[model samples]
Structures are given as structure tokens and as C-alpha cells.
Target chain A: MKTKSTIAIIGSTGNMGSAIAKSLAKGSNRLLLFGREDTKLQTLKNDIHTLNSGADVEAIGCPKDASWEADIVILAVPYAAEAAVAEEIRPYVTQKIVISIANPMNETFDGMVTPADSSAAQELQKLLPDAQVVKAFNTTYAANFAEPVIAGVPADAYVAGDDEKAVQTVTELVQSMGLNPVVAGGLAVSHTLEHMQLLLIQLTVKNNYNWHAGWKILHN
Target chain B: MFSELEKNLRQHITLTTDEFDRVKRYFVPKKLRRKQFMLEASDVCTRMAFVSKGALFSYSTSEKGSINVVQFAFESWWMADLYSFFTEEPSKLYIEALEDSELLLLKADRLQPLLADVPAMETYLRILYQNAYVALQRRLEETIGLTAEQRYLRFMERDGRLLLRVPQHMIASYLGVTPETLSRIRKQVS
Candidate 1:
């Protein structure tokens, strides 16, 4: 039998990272939580241990010297920190699927603050060309990540990358999180998905709607 | 013309020549006169067009009938009202050729068959949609969060090629600013 995929969450102390760790814990996969803050990382480790007794959970403070040899690595840090983090983690990641959830939204609430040609994911991909960079998990809120369904709204997640095998790998991970995975096209198509998230965020703020609303591709 | 199409396809779709032929069979080659509408408001966008040559713009009319340009597709670009194309609902936008154009048009009906016949094309299309979606998200974020000057700088830095290909007015429309305002902003930045 194939060994269950090993998964690591970088910036695991954050809400989104912790939530992803929790979601992956159900699949009998080994989970590694890496973060800059030792106290927060330890709390998350304890929390995951409490909830998922069978899942292997380990937490470590940064300057990640050891190699991260996982089937998948979820970069859950803020957009501002992504470039540096990608640089630091590049040497450690080889032949693994690197998933970037960072959205480069400017702090002033101006939508995305990144260069038009260079998305946070694209930049991360450039930083680690050896790893199959798949952009996923940026659209949905952290709260939605942990919930089976948000207010009965089925959140559809999009997976996009140049690699077919990497996209398939991510599709499975999305399914494991109890969300529908829509193959939204290739790596460049990630621009549209990121824009869709911005539209959703705008609608949420403008209409006083909950961040729980997520998109699904409906086929007749 | 075919080379332009090939280049665009290279960016979006990754398939073997045989696989591309399988998917290409589904598309119908067509020509559009300047200012002709490929798709119009209230029409269901059943097709996506690849610009083999010339240019096209996908836009919407505001309630007052003012045009809001959403996307501009130059040679080798892909143009479609994705929301309308997928949902089969009346499109709120219009897709029209800005210049006399040659195109390879693919309809929704052809998608599944192509996917079935050329499995690699599915990967191509999946990647295409993913890239488009990612761009849309970034644009939306820019519209909401960034200042006008910042947005202009970001747009220029990101799509310098587009700045050269597209007209100033259209760029202003996409940026949600007035053409004169865009000019002034450009002057200030320069």
C-alpha cells in the first residue's frame, strides 16, 4: 500500500495555517508545523495533538535547517513575508508540491498590491522552480477552511499549475478538506481565480455579507 | 497568424501536436470585421475566441450605457465572457473586434469531446482557466485597495506589453479611471 502523504504547514501558527493543519490531520498523514514564534507553534502542536491523536504532529521554530521532505508543503504566511520565506525554504524543498496560499493584498485595503505580472504564487514558483508550485487555498477564509461547510455554502476551491500531476495531487488534498476542487485551468489562469477572490471579498465588504460565501463551478 | 496562435496556446495550453489537433478540430475558424460584435449583452456567450490576428475587447455597458472595458485581447490572446460562457446566461458584457480580425473560435459544446479525445488538452484548458482566474483576482484586489497612481504603476510594471499593444482609453477603462485622468496620471509618473 502507498504510504499516506506527508504534509507540512509553514507559518502554521497563523489562523489559515493552523486551520489547514487541522483539516489535513484527519487523513492519517504526518503533519509538520513550522513557524517563527515558538510559543504559538507549541500551542498549535498541542492543539493538533489533542484533536488528532493518531496523526504525527511536530512543531519547530524557524531557521528551518532540516530538509522538509513532504509530499506537500503549504506556505501559509502573509503575502509580505512570502518572498523571503520562499528564498529561505528553496534549498530545503526538492521534488515536492509547494502550495502558495499567500495573496498580496496591500495593507491599505487596496485589493492586491503585487506586480501585475508577478503574483505572489508566481513569484514563489520563480523562487522554487524545482518544486511543483500549485496555487490553492487563498480564496477561502481560514474559518471556512476548518468547517465542513460554511453556512451550508459549499466552497469550491481552484487548483492551478503547469504540472498535471501537481494539480491532481492538489485536487485530492482539496477533496480531503471537504471542499469541491475545480480545475480552473493552468498556472496563468491563476490570475482569474485570484481576481474572483477579490470580487468575493469586495462583495462581502460592500454588501455586509459574511466571508462564508465561496464559489462553485456548476455544470449542467 | 498560426505562429501567434501557437504562441498564445503555448502560454495557456500544453498539449502534443496530435493532442492539439484533436482539440483544434472542435474550433471553427472565423473572421470579424472591425467593430463587429462577437458577443453582445443579453446574448449567451457560447464561444471563446482566440485572436489569430488583430485585436478584440470584452466590455460591458453601465446602466447609463457607458462602456466599461473588462479585457482586451491582442494577437495571440484569448477572449471570452467566462461568467456568461460557463453559465449560459445572458452576458452583461460585449465582446467585439477592435480591428478586422481572424480568430479560431471554440464553443462550449466542443469542450467535453475535446477533453475526452485529447486528455492533455484538459490539462491545457485547466491551466488556462487557472491563469485567467489568478489575474482576475489580482485585478480585483488592485481596484479595491490601491491608489490610482499605484494601480497605474502596477499595471505598467506588470503588463508593459499590454501598455504598448492597447490604447490609452481602453487602459483607462480597465483601470476604472477616466482617459484624461489616466493621461494626467501618466504624465505625473513620467
Candidate 2:
């Protein structure tokens, strides 16, 4: 039996956010789509509901309201908006399973903008200090989020968080999207995932692996 | 001495008493005096060491023959020239103890069999490598992007314990700055 989780996707109008929303719509989860623009939120809500008629979905103009009702909240915004969005929902983010999928990539996408000591997820955690920030899906491209699988194999999404329950919840969410969730060491492991994104980006641009490429842990 | 290694491994995967007993059998216990080399440059790094007590560091020499610190391993930490250990190539790094240290060395030959014998060992090794890899990646970024003062401050913030234990010059080497520069940075920050 699938657990019906109430998930809020902040910045649902964006590519990564919309892709996650589209994937989650297949499940019996209640989706709270939050965006700056009400019309885009409404369109996304309608599109998601159109795909899964049973999905109880809502369009939220206020980001704070989205965090209030969601069991799991995904900050799907760009790196630039991470701090601002986190600040908006800080009051309502207490103990919320917050998933950060943003990579602090520079404008050129060739290098990272985040400082070496801190990761974007860690920065988000610092802003919403009470929220359980789990880093996931940062390694996979936004293009891959629509399906989250490649070449008949599920893409491995590394998840890192300090809280055990939050990590497990995010892991379940990743699995719900038909992707493999790997419990990467801890919240500090977000440092590695962010760097891994840069390496993947470099490889993709240089080798032309495109959106079809996804990482998998081949263990014996 | 084995307690730290056991506790660290148990955090990730639980092992039965008997399994742990067998696991300990594979590691060759070693003791190194302060400044003694566990591994030297140009040798094939056939083994990896787990520090049970005290501290050690691995470093490489520059073209001018000046040493650059690469990594440090204190209690419960693992160290090796991974490329040389895995590929049977000559090591570019030299690993030496900063203080008299106890270590549990695992040779390359025994590693695979140990993993097969105790599946939890593989999980433990995987977690260890993952941590090491992440730390290295972060350090690389810090070296490339951050200022010396920023790097020192960040290191202090993250690992204050290391700040107290590791020598100033070694920490300077890790941060890619001279000892005098690190001193100035420390003073400025303080």
C-alpha cells in the first residue's frame, strides 16, 4: 500500500519543480504547488491533476502556506532564490522534511557559486534551522526528473541529511518517483553531491551525455 | 584500540561479535614512533592503514622538493595512496606519523577476502571511501576558490579539534598557504 504524503513543491513552475510535481502526481499524494505567479501555479496544479485525477492538488501563492500543510516540502527553486524562499517559510518549517534539489552552480554552469566549506543545502538548513534539510536529486539533471530513469534502470539519487527520519522520508519520496535513493553519509555529504553535480555537468557538456545520463552505484 | 574502529563500523552496519572477531583478525596491528614513515614515496602502496591512536599525515613533494600536506588521519581515520594501492603503481605520497601512533593495516590481498567473508566489512569500507572522497572534493574546491584566511576560518569552524591537535605548519600546508601567512591569518581572525 502506498502512503499518501502531502508534498509541497516550492517553485513548481520551474523545470526541476514541475518535473518532480509530474512524477509525484502518479501517486496518491496530495500535491501543494507553490510559485511566485498564481496563474502558473494554477496551470501546474491543473496539469498534475489532469494526469492523476485522484491526486488531491492545490495551488499556493504564498510559500509559507505551502510549508504549513505539507508533510514533505521540496525546495525546487534555483540556487539564487534558495535563501529568499527559505526565509519566507522559516517560521512554518519546524521539523518539516525539506528536500533541497538545487545546485549552487555559477551563471556559466561551469563552476559552483557556493563556498567550499558550505553547500547550498547546508545554507538552506542554516536559514530554516528547524527544518530537516535533506539533499537529493542535485546530481541528476532537471531534464531527467520527468522520468528519473534511464536505459530501463532507475537513476541513483544520493540523499544526505542529519535526521534519520527525514532522510528515510526523502528516500521514500525518491523511490516513489521510480528512482533509487542512496543514503549518502550525512548532511555534510551534501558537499560531495554538489561537487559531483559539477563533475557530471562537465562530463555532460564535454562528452554530450545529455539528459539521458544518470548515475548508478554498481556494487557487487 | 579496536573499540573506535568497531564503534565507527557499527554506526553504519551492525556485526555480530563473532563477525567482528573475524574482522579484527585480518588487520595487522602496527605501531609507529613519532615522524616514522608508514608509507614512503616511490613504494607501491600495497596496504591501507586505520589509525587506532595518535595522528599521521600523507604528503607529496613539489618540484622544488618542498612538501605539501595532502591528508591527515587521526583516530578511526583511514589513510592510503589509493591509486598506488589499487593499481600496484609507485606512490607519489609519503605517509608519516606526527605522534607515536597505533594502526591496523590491511593489505590489498586480504581486503577482497575480508569483504567476502564479512559482508558488513564492504559496507564499512564503502562508507569510509565515500567520506574520504567527499572531504577531498570539498578541500579541492576550498583550495581553488577560497582565500587563505577564509579557508583557515572554515577549517576552524568545521574541525576545531584538528586546529588544536595538528601543528600550525601542517595546517598551513593543507590550506595551501605558508606558515607565516597562516599565522597572520590566525591573528587577523582571532
Interface Cα RMSD per model, in Å?
A: 21.9, 24.4
Cα DockQ of the candidate 1 complex: 0.01
Candidate 2 C-alpha lDDT tens digits along B1-190: 5888898778899999999887876765555558767777888887788888988899999999888999888898899989888889889899988988877778686788799989988888888889878998999999899888888888889888865888888898988989999989989988
Instruction: Give the range of the ten consecutive residues with the poorest summed lDDT in model 2 chain B.
Output: B24-33
TM-score of chain B of each: 0.91, 0.96
lDDT accuracy of residue A118 in candidate 1: 66
Judged by lDDT against the true structure, how good is candidate 2?
Answer: 0.82
Residue B44 of model 2: what lDDT? 82
Candidate 2, residues A1-220, lDDT tens digits: the string is 1224568899899888888888888887778898777777778878887888888787866787777656678999889988888888775665567899988989888778888799998988888775789998888777786767688888899999998867887888789788888999799999989988888888888898866677888999
What does fnat come to for each candidate?
0.00, 0.00
Candidate 1 per-residue C-alpha lDDT over B1-190 given as tens digits, one digit per residue, 9 for 90 to 100: 2566666667765767876555555655555657767787887887888888888998988888778998888777789989988988888888887888777777676678768887767777877799789989998999999999899999889877756867788889889999999999999999
After the best TM-score superposition of candidate 2, give how far the Cα of residue A170 lies from its true spot, in angstroms: 0.8
Off by over 4 Å in 2: A1-3, B1-190
- Which segments of candidate 1 are over 4 A away from where they belong? A63-67, B1-190
